[model samples]
Target: MAKELQKLFEDLKREMKQEFRELKESFERELRKDVRDIKASMSFINQCYEEMKASVKKVEAENEALKESISTLKEEREALYAQVKEQESRLMQNEQHSRCLNVEIKGVPR
Candidate 1:
């Protein structure tokens, strides 16, 4: 009876060890899967960051181009204003000359 009890205890111990090993293997598999998921998420985040950086650079370049265009337009506007002033001065001079050349012949006709 003592021998039988010893055999039964040995069998129980072996079964427990097997169960523990299986549980540990399952836990390790789950941990590895979670780590892989986290890695994939990090990779996706990095990609998004890179894309955003590129987009920002593109926008900055476009902004610089727009600034240059605005500067050119301002210069053209100043030049056009100068031309308008010159034309106005010429028109005033012509009007003064015409007024000086006018004649009053009122006594000879009536």
Candidate 2:
């Protein structure tokens, strides 16, 4: 009977060890899969980051070009305004000179 009990205990211990080994293998496989997924996600995120940086650079260049264009337009507008003012002043002077040359006699017959 004692020998039989020893044999049974050894058999149970072997089965338990086998189960534990299987569980360890399953855990390692799951860990490896999770690591692979994390790596893929990180790679995708990095690619997006690079693309966004390139886009920002392009937008910044465009913004600078627009600013220069606006500055040039503003300069042109000011120059045109000054020219218009000068022309108005000349017209007023000509009108005043012309009025002095006009003689109106209402009572005399033509």
Candidate 3:
């Protein structure tokens, strides 16, 4: 009877060991799947970051080009303003000379 009891206990221990090994294997598989998912997510985030960096560069280039265009336009406007002022001065001088000439002609008496 003692031998039978010992054999029964040994069988129970072996069964429990087998069950523990199966549980450990299942846990390892789950952990590996989770790690793979995290890696994939990290890769996707890196890709997004690269795309955003490129987009920012493109926008900055466009902004610089726009600033240059605005500067050129401002220079052209200043030149036009200067030309207009010069023409106004010349017209005023011509008008004054014409008035002086008219007065001289009248005084001379044709």
* Candidate 1 steric clashes: 0
| Error at 55, model 3, angstroms | 0.4
The prediction achieving the highest TM-score against the true structure is 1
Q: What order do candidates take by lDDT, descending?
A: 2, 1, 3
Candidate 1 residue spans exceeding 4 A from truth: 104-110
Best by lDDT: 2
Give RMSD to native, each candidate.
Answer: 2.7, 2.4, 4.1
Prediction 2 TM-score vs. true: 0.77
Model 3 ranges off by over 4 Å: 103-110
Clash pairs, model 1 backbone: none
Angstrom error at residue 58, model 1: 0.3
| Per-model TM-score on C-alpha atoms | 0.81, 0.77, 0.79
From the highest TM-score down, the ranking of the candidates is 1, 3, 2
Q: Can you write out model 3's per-residue Cα lDDT over 2-100, one digit (the tens) per residue?
A: 999999999999999999999999999999999999999999999999999999999999999999999999999999999999999999999998887
What lDDT score belongs to each candidate, Candidate 1 first? Answer: 0.98, 0.99, 0.96
Residue 78 lDDT in candidate 3: 100
Better-scoring candidate (TM-score), 1 or 3: 1
